[model samples]
Target: MKKQTLLVAVLAALSVQAGAAVPEKTADTVLKPQPGQTQAAVWASRVLTKLHYKSTPLDDAMSEKIFDRYFKSLDSEKMFFTQADIDQYAVVRTRLDDAITGENLSVPFAIFNLYQQRFNERIAYARELLKTKFDFSTDESYQYDREKVEWAKTDAEVKDLWRKRVKNEWLRLKLAGKDDKAIRETLDKRYDSYLSPSRKLTNEDVFQIFMNAYAMSIEPHTNYLGPRAAEAFDIAMRLSLEGIGCILQSRDDYTVVREVIVGSPAALSGKIKVGDKIVGVAKDDKTPMTEVLGWRLDDVVALIRGPKDSTVRLEIVPADAGPDGKHATIALVRQKISMEEQSAKKTILEVKDGNVKRRIGVISLPTFYQDFEARRKGDKDFKSATRDVARLLAELKKDKVDNVLVDLRNNGGGSLSEAVELTGLFIDKGPVVQQRNGENKVEIESDTNAGMAWDGPLGVLINRGSASASEIFAAAIQDYGRGIIIGEPSFGKGTVQTLFGLDRFSQNDKVHYGELKFTIAQFFRINGGTTQLRGVTPDIKLPTMADSDSYGESSYDNALPWTQIKPAVYIPAGEVKEIVPLLDKRHEARVSKDKDFQYLAEDIALVKKQRKENSISLNETVRRKERDTQEARSKLREARLLATPGADDPILVPDPKDALNKAIAAKPASGKTAPVPKVAGVKGALRSDDGLQGSERTLAAELEAEKAAKAAKDVLLNEAVHILADEVGLLKTDTRMALRVLPYAADTK
Candidate 1:
């Protein structure tokens, strides 16, 4: 009999949740692959080998890559498993492909069991070390970047590395002004929290992690999403979820409310607040409450979420209440919570062009969103990025704006159709983007709309975070000469990912086999060049902290190479290229004297210098001095910018929800809508675009740092506005001169 046939017979007697029976010698519950998972592994492997853009075979060579990737995913810092463990597992390194293909998952599960054991040992050792005192005066450094380092050869070597790691943690708290007692308590809680999350990982989670290691070995974008992750992905894409409307995070075996969304049930109830701990949950008022204090976050969330209008009761300990304090019961009816924050928003900037004041409309799109379910239900007013943008453009046109700018600084793309439809709003009709499959067959995606929304002066703002669909829209606008692309070069992720729910391929509807997201096609600009690694180069580049080589798609190993095909048949919408040289010249002159721009350049230089360091000093005095120096420099720069003439605070714009509500209320009984009220323009903060940081600063200090970062971004937006204003002026005065092409950078194609 075949291995798959034998495995099917064995799986027939195993339980879905518990999987195969564990041995009596095992102290803790050992996670094993279920029957559905083995089937999914086989199906996913077949799909990747046959349909993936890379079309890489699942052979011994690929299996070795998956083996390395799996270990990296499990313990990238090389602190958990030793070289001996790796050597012991070497027998199965090149056999993973055969095992997956044959529907045998014993090797991966056995490896994961050993990893779990090693993880527990390390955590226990860390907890024990927290009981001892460390000398912070020692002049030693901890190399946190261990990606290129070899694994420890022995247990003693790993333990010594842990000693240095614990010391580094202690030094950070000490520099943050924590007392020895507080440091011990905090470290103890943190170590326990780390162990809690890892120990709570289910078999499904491990399977997803291992499968992704297999998929991404072929390319960076290919991934496998477990059932839980798949739901979260859908929520992100749809920008809405049916829940109580609060964010939760795991902390020391407790599910704590991190934030209460402004318009969520939790926010309206006024009973739940940030930092509150959820202790128990009940299906409804009548059902018995189930204690969930130590349950995994995803499990707790699953219990809390229900169908719309259904009641889910939560027992909580308030933020101000101690863990031993009284617990309160709160009942909230689940409802659709629209993540309006992620939706498109608009502001009108009154920029100065010489002595004339020009009104410029700016629309900030965080993502290309679409309510897929609502659209599939044939709802005429379904929410979509294109629909919202079209409405915003109409309102901006009514405000008599001279030009409009679409801000896509950190948009990581969504809904390829939305990108095409959004591009259609600017031009009458044209091909937006092209997709080439593995078979070299190209499909052209275009906008067949007959009319334009606002054919005025246009500008597109992008950064290293702008990718995929964002690149497509920006590239189309640039290719059609419809707008001037601004900011840094975008993230060069030109691949298209198609998500396949694995359960669809199975006969059993009761089992959730998770989902697979794999790259199917490569996106090409209408101008013929692929945006794979080169991304969409801006017509006018601005000062950015993002470096193309280190930050974008090119940074990933085995990323698809840049290529080009024959350009799609299209006509130029309007000529903005010839005038780009004048805009660039003016932009340079203005920013040269701008204080905010100078400060931003200096900060970027400091960040680049910091990125070069591989380790941090464990000495408290040295670390504290370094932190103080950087903080002091940041403060001085902020003060200088604040002192600069005309450096006003950002204007406040009306909330998008409030504006929409007002518009609806003002509509006539006959159904004609009234004009949206004009509110002061506001600049969207770019703090998140800078990426995450591990700072030991106080909350107040961090807030101030964020404020300074936003002020710097205002300078970039201000410069883009000025450039658009200049474009409007040049076009109005002399069309012939504005249409004259000048010698500048070569076209992207």
Candidate 2:
């Protein structure tokens, strides 16, 4: 992990959104309010019904008190808030409990109002603290210090921290090129956007933060799925959306790009790389831009992501620049991102050892995904990722691939059932994993039976993005010694979520309908090892992400501790130790001074340094200089790769006479045609951005249409065949990871 603390914070922020807002609703049995009943009580009754609360005989005062207590307890330190901050919230909390018991609107409304007010105050405090400084490196340290101090001491301490922090931040800002005037102006703009009435900060912001905190408190996996948040996630996973195809996050005041999907219009346009701060968004040059400083990341994303085929202009402060730097407006076109690009496809490399030929099979699984909607509709034709993988394996087997490499890098897991099924493809009948629910009950999911698809020398490649179900599959394979695990430690997401419907309890038109995602279970490896904060250990120790933001379980806030129940019996295929030295040697030889690897290493270091800083200048000139340096570096890297032989060579289509390639494309499912040929003399070879036919085809004349179609169909299979022919039955490297338990956490890689 780059900085363990920062990594943990970011992971917590990302993972805690799964199993949140566990709603505990009661049935609203109240028929109606009495004629002489107070308006507060009458209104409360109706509201309770609408909210799906089971109306009890209890009165208004009690309900208010209960709700108040729940809110305060969740934020006791006033880091969000504490009981001491208010004089009579204690009474209000009591009243809330009573209000929920009966249908009293007055007390319920009052409680709701109080909650909103306190929530607003909490948001204010959080914003202020962002601008302040602190010596505390961890949340625990901050909590401890907060608890020890009295009110007066706390106030003074906070003030002192702020002064010191602000001064340091200001210095960084100056270096980034912001003068005092620019700084003031920027701050004024931010204040207007964040605190203005039009923004709805007091209501919407508080709601969001409260939901986030609530999710974190329950369990790392549980989360409140706000409509907008859900929408954002869907767009991200689909790898397509309007506006820019960049993932953004809020760090204190600025909105930063966390990741950029490769080949997106933004990436293709040579504009707006990761870590860029989005200062403003506009529809066109004639339109006035909206400054987004100090806004929530979600809100900023909402503004950027819109309808498909639409364009949005962004004013960006590229990383490595100061204030008063040149801000460029980048235009981007939204296009559907092909999932195949992210998947593990095949490539053939020629390797000769004393006239011996070997073939290697590369299959990339980007997230263990199975489209739930398609499955639920009983659509047998629905895209089953496992099925595709199984077919790929079968084809590879025909190609006589000597070794198989399963790439799972950047795959944040999906579809639990798919994980088990995917794992089943490699092993015989056995327990896959154990799940422990809230009541401490356990259920073991087992593979019914298994026939190995293509069990040649296998290697599973993982990275930080490989999490949850992905971790489970990788861990199982590692434990069984079925394959070698390569790359980095898997993401620690051991929890399982269950959705609870809230619509069933609501009454009337107020629509208290929603879903509560709760962490109902924790996943355990068959060997009885927990993958909670400690993800699966890789077999080969790779030197990557050593200083990257990718974090293990321990990095997450309030993450569940790693523990074991009992190990499930599992048989080992082979010990990985026998090939450790050879794998190490190969990796060393392959990566040593390799330009691509070296560039990646340098990029990671620079990014780590950039993330650690808190403030930068608002000046234009300085910012432009920084942006230029980054752009130049990127262009240089691209040029270098192009200069390398075979590195930038376009993929070639398989020839009909290629036997090894033909073996890889024996069959194709209906409606799923074979890949097109990449050869120059092919139909549908070159097209516009939106008209990209396939990776297998090259732009050519229509006179060669028939030949081109056949050629294109064999491209994927041909590559697979070539890989298999060269690597199959050759020597294999096994040592993938060096696992050890450090004092802080388990090292998966």
Candidate 3:
């Protein structure tokens, strides 16, 4: 997984009550054809053609076809409508067709009003249907008790449902009083507080509610964002806005921090971390803080993010801590976080086995990011993740690194264009990903650029956060045997959103409606496989605390299913299957004996278990017990590591002489604290073939610090030199090495 992957809002609007009875329309109010109508029709026809809508000479027949399709989608089961209603709808459809074709504004406008009226009636009926418990499946399979529709006939039964809703709301207030009066006051206060907002409910509010209900019926990810939410939606895609630099969600009335960006203000500040519950937010350091305990995530985010350099104070209660948790005010100054900030940085690690050494250059990409704003602004000097990694690879080559590990742990993908471009960096170009639209039209995305940057033994690491473009690139590499993928399943977010300009059609009072964001396309790998619900599977599975399977597009409320398209013509690069067996053996051996692997696995399991727990006892005694348990667990792990075989020996401590001296004395002479020298042989009594092992190596290793820092190349680079040297028997090669021909996945091949 590329580091640039993980980059990725909520609205709270109330529903409205509708009139019990429906109204009828008269013929006199219907639009009459005028002499200038033909000209208007021509204009409308030209506009639709320009917009690339399937115009098909939209006359009476085309209009009727569109109406049938629309109606079927609305009532797919053919329920709720009587024969008479169907006949009436057909007549209305014909009238609407004529109105639209004739370009008569009155008819279409009148039709819209009738549609709204009917939609409201439908909503009222649906609300009533809720009283009659319909079999609603929690899962997508929809396998449930669908034997009968039990309608609530009595007023008591209907009120019971209302009471359940009220109880749920009250429970959200954290009220637990044996006395009825106190609990009642708490419930009333909760309701009053929510209702006290002076914001007036407008027609747009009603539209949003309707749109959300409509979208929800489709799927969870398919959401309707009224014009008001367009700004936020756009910002999410661009991924260049300032906030706590974390994704947030409303998990049961509490806005929880989902994931923290690696180097974001939230992560850097080290104040508000993941799993912390935001209790309240004070804007511009206001004295009166608005309690956000039960606010929607979007509402909370709005308060959190502002203009660059502005500060928003947050009061957070750490999840590890209790309600009376230590509350601190941390002021964060916002900055324009660039794509470069979210990119992958290269680090070389030298792994030693006996006398042999291997250099693994790790490119830890925080995200698959591109400077989209800069690109859009027509700035040719845009920061590109793929390009940056290429440069890093070149630098590593100069150090004579052996292998490359692409760390994409928490990378959420950004910019489809960048994905294709990055995919090109590794292979002889071909189609990387396929995008299938709603119309079944497939668009093949490829790396048009020529050549590969660095094609040594490649391994890509991904986790649950890797999605979309990340999936695209990873799938291509895995399918083509270009690289071995490691980690958990990638996040399945393969849907392409098409933003429709709603303002073009209608206007409500002052604010014009913006866009109708819909899933217009689905992403597929070059192998004709879609990364929709089931994200790309890794080649070498690694231990991850993340439960990517529990969340993401497939698990989402309205996510599209995983499917496939016609396979593109391509061939596997080489046989990397041997590496899989090697990795599996290595992993098993490590898991069996390595203390770090065991500890990491246990830690992940513990965290996952902790995440599943709901309410914790707030009592002081229980809280203290929990804290003590955590402390005990932490100490136990630390003790276990210290007792491990290789670590049990006494170690040398560092002093003012610096890390080099400390490294020389640590446990084994080959110290873990210092960097190993890259030269063919060490000075003094140390010979190239002296072959120091274990504790000796630990103690003898030179502390990689001041000397390495002042040197042209760092200690890590020097270690990499030793690894690559051991590989090709070029340890004595003093000549500087450079990448001769970098490979690129060919898009047009």
* Best candidate (score: TM-score): 1
Task: List per-prediction Cα lDDT, in the order shown.
Answer: 0.78, 0.52, 0.52
In the range 1-749, model 1's lDDT, one tens digit per residue, is 01111111122111122211221223377877888899989988888899898999999999999999888777777888999999999999999999898888988888888987887788789889998889878898887767668989999999998999888877766766778898887777666655554555567756876897898899989988777667777887889999888878655567888666665777667677666889899978789998887776667778888898999999999766788999999999998988887999898877655677778889999999998989999999888999999999999877888889999999999999999999999888879999999999999999998878977778999988999999999999998888999999889999999998778888887877778899999989988998898888899999876855457898877799999999999988766777888889988997888777887888898777765676778887898888788667766665655443362322333447767865554443445443221222222232221111222222233445555555553667777887887887887687455443211111211
Order the candidates by TM-score, highest first: 1, 2, 3
TM-score of each: 0.86, 0.55, 0.51
Badly placed stretches (over 4 Å) of model 2 are 1-198, 201-208, 227-361, 391-402, 438-441, 544-550, 574-577, 585-749
lDDT of 2 by residue, 399-472 (tens): 76556777777777876788888888877667788887656777888778656775555677777668888888
Better of 2 and 3 by TM-score: 2
Estimate the TM-score for candidate 1.
0.86
Candidate number with the higher lDDT (1 or 2): 1
Instruction: Output the TM-score of candidate 2.
Output: 0.55
For candidate 1, what's the RMSD?
Answer: 7.9
